[model samples]
Target chain A: MTAAAPPLLTVEHLTMRFGGLVAINDLSFTARQRQITAIIGPNGAGKTTVFNCLTGFYKPSVGRLTLTPPNNGGCFLLERMEGFRIAKDAGVARTFQNIRLFAGMSVLENLVVAQHNRLMRASAYSVAGLLGLNRYTRAERQAVELARYWLDRIELTGQADWAAGNLPYGSQRRLEIARAMCTEPCLLCLDEPAAGLNPRESAQLNELLLDIRGQHGIGLLLIEHDMSVVMQISDHVVVLDHGAPIAEGTPDMVSNDPAVIRAYLGAAEGEALPPDVAGGLPTAPPC
Target chain B: MLKDALAAAVVAALLALPLLGFRLADSQQGLSLDYRFAWVGYAAAAVFIGRLGMAFAAAAFSRVFQRKRQTLLPLAGRPSRNRKIVGWLLVAAALLLPLAPFADRNLIDKATLLLIYVMLGWGLNIVVGLAGLLDLGYVAFYAVGAYSYALLSQTFGLSFWLCLPFAGALAACFGILLGFPVLRLRGDYLAIVTLGFGEIVRVVLLNWESLTNGPNGISGIQRPSFFGLPFLAAAPGRTTFHEFFGLPFSPGQRIIFLYYVILVLALATNLFTLRIRRLPIGRAWEALREDETACRSLGINPTRTKLSAFALGAMFAGFAGSFFATRQGFISPESFTFIESAIILAIVVLGGMGSQIGIVLAAILLVGLPEWFRDLQQYRMLAFGGAMVLIMLWRPRGLLASREPTIRLAADALEAAPQTAGEAAR
Candidate 1:
């Protein structure tokens, strides 16, 4: 409600369906500014589907998905915008669950391409772009320079010319993030960024996420199953199951929630925990 | 090693024949400064240089320049500040080389023709390679361009230079029109539509007697003059271009001047294409080519991107066509056949899609080799076809295969990545 503390993106009662299937059901959540938020659950728990909705891949069947800009300028109903426009206008960028990169292009080109819409806007100046124009060349040089700047940020200057598809699995994952970062979005949604990463790579990804949040002033909405990554990096955690949020709180809170425990850790694990305050010893943190 | 050397030797010899002892229309002996050989040689040189240069440049660039990749004549790398100055110096030297005392006029002509094909290849490269849209009827635009120039120049007595832009615009309009109807098709279906479009244009040219002068085609089309001087060996009353330049009157002089004109145009095409390729529009083309669905997700209207590709390609073809009419001093539908389209497609495919150097090489091989084998006339096509089949089998991707896929994300994200890096390294 307050101008100073605008939630970056707010989705209220969002539902998406495919014929008889409900992928996301009555889901409501908010990604606050400058925080690492994690959505975690078992497979088919609709963690990715939530990301899809935020990124405008799947339009919600019902309810409003408002992306309130940082300064509370105007809210964007994300469902109203198409995928690319969502990224461009709403400043919402997302990485796929699996690494998706222009493998044929250079690592540098991949990052540069993410900023395509920006360049297109600059070139809209007619004569400057046509007639073998001079003004357009200057703008084009700047785009290349910016692309170079991102490549440096990701520590990928050495492999800038290498095809993106050829990078190591972990490197490709990082490149995807760097690419999403190139668009300079207000909120970055990452889907299973650490899926196949080794411990070191996963740790590296965590550091990147924190850097993205701290230095870039970008909010991260990550869907990660890696407990260490989620627990260590996330400022807030939302636990989902079967297209519904089961628990929403801090990492410690969601980890201890009875419903989260039953759904993720299983019913047997939940039943073993004592209900008495003194006996349970630890209470879950607040949402 | 011996076999490789022999093959290389044969190619070099075949390329040099025009300079050494070939004949052009009998009066000119020692390598005909014809468009066919010029285009062929230009492309061969681009590929030969691109592949070899990649290796050597990669090593030198890494050592001298603290850059990420080795790109000698890179498709994307900006030269260092010092290198930029040096590059311009080299460009100046190249421009002046033809004026050098030692430079052969035939060499100049060949170089000029190479420049023209480069433009055509660069143009075709946009639609077929960058956009991943097959256009089997590109020559139709070439015909449109030639006819536009021919008709306008003849009717209005407009100069070739003045009519060039008009020719390009006319062809571009047709390109966009073709793009709209074919929007619903994909792959082979799209190819079929474009092929049909090309055939329709040719048929119209052949049948439209009132306008196109029917099957005999438009003749006595004026040859472009240098300034106001006509390039003739003997004109009864007036000073020909040769006498105006104070050179001994020779037929070779005219061929040389046309070569330079085409060279300039071709170079312009190359520069234009290079500039465009680095733009966001070029990247968008690559994206659309890779995955139309993802491109839409990115808010790039596929219809627009495709139309741009079609229009840009057609514009260049038109430019080529106008020059073609000027060069031949004639115009006809016979030159705009499906076979011509196929050859151009073959050049793009053989060169490697979206690869400028590769396409040039392919064009040179396809066009020049056939001419070189003219002694074996009937067997020439058989050799060309067999070579194409063999190259496809060996490279499968093409002669100079592209390893980097345009689209990164797809149905199989897992499989596409390794291929990307592996091809670059290879």
Candidate 2:
């Protein structure tokens, strides 16, 4: 991917405090257009807090979060906007760390719900829709088409009619991603998308994320504990420890950085690196 | 199992102690205590035997039923085609009820009452079932509708037909008014606020003597006429309904007319709800019910979605309340109380939330059965309470727990659309 264009989303000096505790401290990063940016950190490093701030779930105690859409539809100061407006007007969609599909609804219904604003307009505030008018029908058919497209992409076409809660864990995760994609976001934020997946499912998720970024040209911001996924698919990586950024660079540069190693291994001087960290980068320079 | 039986015996003894073990009697010699040990022993024995028999019966029943569970419970969860057929059959029966040979004035009255509850159930279903808002004071809307019609018709000498829409609009306004303050609350807190709102409405109706006539209530409320013709034996200047129809003046004719009026009203409520369930607003309600935060993430304004549910639900309840006031020819604070709301809420809950037909079944069971067994007046509520408990134990999810999605994909939608179009053409 080229780096000439301005970044799609920029987070600068973000800080979030809960009472006496600081969850995210002076975090800064950038996610370029059509590129995958992974934020990796040990537990309690405030990676998820950064995501919450960017997505407007939390108003950071201090920060300027900006998003420049490809269409040049004016940058959105996300910190000043409400969460739903950030998703709706700014075209930013996100999935929860824990799967939050409308579990009682069918898989297809979950996807259709993501397109609620479009459908609501097509229905003209439901006046025409209740009458079963042609225009409303056309809009509804288009929505079904878009939903089907995402379902096919997610390989959940066969499970479209099943209640989303009844799906297997991996399938639920994929469906959550598909549901977020149905919103047609410019920036997709995923928190721990591969948390409970097995190795095979995790690899598939990596391919899916890569495919989404490459095909749709949507920016991807991922917070993941799975080192293998973070190292394999990310174009840029940011490492955080104790609520602060420790390293930021391309995957290779950050993986081999000594500061990143010490952050993961708890500052031990001579201990051997964990297998996940060692295996993530097969060829690392001796420290 | 033995321990359970022993516990049951002990519980029975405790229960019997107050009733049988000691009794105080006032006579010429003053108070005297009587011990009824025989009654206590018999109660304990009955409890022990009943407990043992229930255990054995349950074991045997499960052993027999569990073997061929799939075959025996073919319609347990998935009732796609069969459910539709049953629904149509029910509608047909209800429509033909007034014309049935066995129909009598008493039966028609009971059926009308049942239909009113059915309408209320469908209305509350929008808020409680679809939007997952626990409104404990639904009867406030009902009271608003009834009082609106009663006050309008009496004060302005307006006809029932003219006041009906006004009543409904007033109730909807009240719904929105109540909705705003409770928008941020959920679950139990919402329920308590709603309950308080209901009591407030009832209390206002009781205390507002100048407008509501206090506890005396408003009587001689005008009944709904057939168009402009009143259903009277004779009119001085205008022709009565019986005279216009050139039929003998039988009181049953008016009862039958009232039944059809409410029947149409209730069916309209059902049709409107069914149609709205497929619309965007309806989907928004269901989505909000599932997850409010997820709904917001998808750009759905929770306030608007929840308000729509409340207003629409209240509107329908208003329609029913107008019918109620007109039918009874009276309006009072006593009619709309917390117990009324509780019964309506129970119908929705026991009917399985969001299931239209389930509401009808539950209303019939909860309302109709108790009315039918009114001869057992002392034990009526006891039996009703016991039935509710038994139903909860047996089907905790509700009588009709299986849900059918409102939306389908292209493959199913295409198939469904063509068939409906063909039916329309036919």
Candidate 3:
């Protein structure tokens, strides 16, 4: 990605502490527009912590998170905003490592709820919707159309009326992405989007992420365990170990970095490992 | 299995022995131990038989449906065409009951009481059912409404209609006040705080004698009228509802009038709930209910959605409360105690949390049956508890626990709701 492409989200000197433990320390990264920036990390690497701070689920001990959407919405200093405002005004949308679809609602309703802010405005904060007025109806139809488009894109149109929880695990993953996209966010943060998928579903997820990055003019910040997804589709990759960036470059460069390998495989076993090695290292790639 | 059942019986007998085997009998001289060991044997025998049967049933059920249950969970809450017919039939019966041959003043009065509960259940459903906020202080809003109407009507000499909006507004303000502190809580913690809030409201009313009249609640409150005509006998100079309609003066006119008033209020509540479910706010309630974190992540404000639900639900409760005060021609803190909150909560749960039609059936079962069984007297509570236990065992959800989605998109989608299990357990 070119430096002149313009950054969508700029994180500066981000630090998060829970009591005495520093979960993330001095973490900083900039994700550019129309790019898939993957944060690949071992377990306990605080990838989700960074996403949490960016999404306003947590206020970092010290940090600045600036998200500038291409639509000329003012720069959102996310760390200072309320949890909902980060999404509402800053246009930052995310899906969870554990899928967080509105499980009781229908698939279509889930998508429609993603467009809640827009429809909420059109419905005049619900007075018009209560009266079933024309403007609200037109806006609601348009919201459904957006939901329908995403459903078709995600190939979930048939299950549009199914309760979201009842969907197959793979479909739930895809549907979660669709729901996030329905928000029309400038920056989408996905926490382990391919966590529980089968190989085929993982490939499909990679393709979907690629499609979103290539066509939607939206920035994608993904925390992925699937090497195929990260190495295949990501425009840039940031490798994290011990809650700090160990390597940063294109996916090929990060994959080839010795520090990244050491973080994952743990110093080739019995090579006099350091005293503070964060936590256990996985013996193999999760994928 | 027989040996396990025998062990359970032995434990059960040992537990019951102290309570049932020896009771302190009142004698002329003093208290003496009286052996009632037969009751202990009966208790042991019941447990033994129940344990054995349940064990056998569990084994059979597992053997039969172990694989099928997984596939069937999603199919449970679909509303079939016949069920819709049943719902409408129930409504029709409710609407036509006053004209029935057996209808009496007492029966209509009881029906009106049942309708109040139905309205309360619907109102509470928006908060507890749709938004998934378990409000144990809902009766506080109801009390607020009643007190608002009573105090305003008496002090200001305002008509019931004039005070109605004030009552609702006051209750809504109280709801928002309660909501602000409790929005950060969830599930059990939220319920705990709300439970305290209800008691606080009741205690305030009990002590604030100056404004509320304390234990001696404000009386001679104004009654609601039909449009501009009052529901009273036509005096020498004034025209009452019966007089205006040219019908003969009958005391039953007031009862029927009160019944219709509550019925309309309850129907309007149900309609509002129905319409809102299809709107953005209603959908937001459901979404927030599903997961607050997800809601915030998606740009829907959890605080606003939850507050709106609480306020709207409280507003309806206020309306019901105003009607309730006018209906009884009296008001007091005693009427809005913790037990009333429990009963309302029970109706919502017993009707299946988000199910609209289920509230009607629940109201009939929980409120109607008790009023009809007033002759049962001391045994009323026993029968009520027994019926609730039986229903929980049978349905474990509610009588008509069907949740059809407010809107649908897929062609020929299954009519049943997929949210068949969990959530309500909260």
DockQ of each: 0.13, 0.43, 0.47
TM-score of chain B of each: 0.71, 0.90, 0.90
The reply for model 1, stretches above 4 Å from the true place, is: A1-5, A120-153, A244-247, A256-287, B1-116, B181-189, B204-210, B213-216, B232-253, B287-306, B393-426
lDDT for each residue of candidate 3 in A1-287, tens digit (9 for 90 to 100): 56578899999999999999988989888999999899977788889999999999999999899898998957889999999998888889999999998887788889999999999999999999999999999998898889878977887666666678888888899999999899999999999898888888898888898889888979999998777678788888887787888989887677767688778776233222221222234344332
* Predicted model with the maximum lDDT: 2
Candidate whose DockQ is highest: 3
Error of 1 at A98 (Å): 1.9
Off by over 4 Å in 3: A1-3, A267-287, B1-8, B26-29, B50-79, B234-236, B410-426
Tell me the deviation in Å of residue B402 in model 3.
3.6
lDDT of model 2 at position B93:
96
- Candidate 3 displacement at residue B409 in angstroms: 0.7
Give lDDT tens digits, candidate 3, residues B1-426. 999999999999999999789999899989998999999999999999998998898788875645644433333334357767886887788899899999999999999999999999999999999999989989999999999998888888888888888989999999999999998999999999999999999999999999998999878777788887887775567778887888988888889889988988998999999999899999999998899999999999998999999999999999999999999889989999999999999999998888888888888899999889989999999999999998887567676554666666634332322332332221
lDDT of 1 by residue, B1-426 (tens): 334444554576576656643435534565544435665565556545644655565566666644322332222233235534643564475478677897676566555555566667878988998888999999999999999999998899999888999999999999999999998688999999999999999999999999999889899888888887898887789888878878888777777778778767766776776667667788888877766654544445567778988998899999999999988887788888999888888888888887666776677788766755678978888998888886785455665554332222222322322334442453
Better of 1 and 2 by DockQ: 2
lDDT of 3 at B417: 24
Classify candidate 2 by CAPRI docking class: acceptable
**Which parts of model 2 have CA positions greater than 4 angstroms off?**
A267-276, A279-287, B60-79, B410-426
lDDT scores in order: 0.74, 0.87, 0.86
